[model samples]
Target: MKKRFARFKSGWSLNRIFHDVTGALFAPLLISLPVWADAQPIQTLTIMEYRAHLNSDQPTVRGMIKFADLVSEGSNGRLAVTVSGATVPGSPEDQIKALQEGGPHAPDMMLLVTPALRHVEPEFEIMDLPFVVHSDRQAHELLDGPVGRELMSRLESHGLVGLAWWENGFRQITTSGKSFIHATDLTDRPVRVIPEPAFVETFKALGATVVSLPYPQLYQALKSGRAEAQDNFASQILVGHLYDVQSTMTVTNHSYSAIAVVANSAVWRRLSVRDRNVLQHAAIEAGRYERDLIREQAKTDSAELAHHGMTVHSLSPTELARMEAMTEPVRQQFFRSYDPKILDLYRHQIGTRWITR
Candidate 1:
């Protein structure tokens, strides 16, 4: 069967069709279900995130905390969630492998980048195409709509259950000194890309010498001059202190970088009906909250980046158009990766949103 996803700038696969207020108002109600379980053992689930605990918590981290709280409350403490964001025990890759294994050794849930999920389900890469999603609104429609449900269904094949989409926000570009306002600026630049085909291919099309690396290794790559450029949300630049590594920030907003909150299918299936509703509902609500927080934080973080001596540039329509032109080939390559039905849905969703804009 064909899988699906929505293109989102906030790190995602979605098409935003519903009103923001609708999500906020009805989310709790949607999860409310008739109590069916009389007895259930208390269970503690581990939640893993890629970044270590920073001085300031990102909204994504905050959302995980919120999810944990709601689950405990809704389950009347029968379900407890423990969160781990540190890198000491293992890398994100290791954690993902563990979750996929899903016996006694796996995390119950993990918040992962959309690109990272692509490794398990290649169909997910459909949402990784650059410039496909024009705004966060469109992303929400795609994800919350049928397209997202289809993509989440694909997770079953990989031993995962996608709970909800969270935000990493629109990725911006950073360079050591040279800025890529236009494609030509990338000539000979060694850009650090997420370890994903879409990222590598996109940067190459824009004329960069690309290197793939783990998030932990990015700062050193820039500091040691092994790499001079990378992309991430503005908040990441501030919290990760990437400004110290790359002195220039351009609001390329080229592609979306989304993280998914997913559970091991085995664990999820073992949950009581009411508990499943509680956890999934809590995850969706937390995701919306996290997305809002990330958007708010980006405003202040960009200014802080400028104060910290990093040149921050927001793209004009002309330059954004240029970027789309440069990355056209990469988009085409991914366009054929989806079923015709998925593409048709994308066109109607994105095209409608575009006309309204």
Candidate 2:
């Protein structure tokens, strides 16, 4: 026994014994270290952005991309955003439906125009009303203030969470036959307007024979004489090559168009409060970037359109006033149809005197 004990002590010295004890004690912790390092798994989100023009320079598409980047970086890769464009099937309306359904195939978020949202919530039409918002600054004031918040809040009941208001710039008139010098110049012209009621009524009030055609069909319609004029943003005119078919562009700025960044309510609720906040802040920041891009592009587009041999005209103050007066009834009808509180909020933000009942 004495010989065996001496052999054991010689083989296992103090350092060896100490190292064995610590190694045994830390084995479980060392094995569990990886789990601790990845306590939170990364969440990947899908965003379906619909744009008639999906070019790399498209402001709204770029904005959506910026939003995705901001969300990913802000979350430190915890939230990953994958942006898919027109590749997603169906119209904007159909896409909204899919988003609401919420499945493996449904997108977590979508950017929808106000007109598309109008069917879900009619108050959305208020944004499309002619002459309601006169300038970019005024639009920003209305949307970034209480009026905008209230409008977005209405979507919550419909399983949507509105994050920010992006712009499509102001709508301008492009005509194939003649320059719209006076409100009456639009009279009896075959003008293509968005299928939205307000847009139809506004052009009708000016005496234009309004035609509602899908955006993709617009070029052919004008080319074939099926439609003579259309109202859209300068970017649309440039991107859609409307200048090729339409010879005149009038800077009507009749209506300010806004796109909403919305998320599926179910998806939004699943996110942590911290993650949601990150998305919200990112959306707003990216929206500002998009708006700046659109405004800058508008300035350049006018010159480009002129270069393309399309005459660009700015409506005289008198003609704009006449057009505004003609569309007043449409605005009133809208005011009467929607929630009074929303109307009041809009009036308050845009100046109560601007829209009197």
Q: After superposition, how far is residue 282 of candidate 1 from its true place, in Å?
A: 0.6
User: What tens digits encode model 2's per-residue C-alpha lDDT throughout 80-117?
Assistant: 66655433355657767877888876778888889888
State the lDDT of candidate 1 residue by residue for 313-340, as single tens digits.
8877887888888888787777666566
What are the per-model numbers of colliding residue pairs?
Answer: 18, 0
Query: What lDDT does candidate 1 reach at residue 59?
Result: 80
- Residue 97 in candidate 2 has what lDDT? 84
lDDT of 2 at 347: 70
Best by TM-score: 2
Off by over 4 Å in 1: 1-41, 53-56, 87-93, 352-357
Question: TM-scores of the models, in the given order?
Answer: 0.83, 0.87
- lDDT of candidates 1 onward, in order: 0.72, 0.79
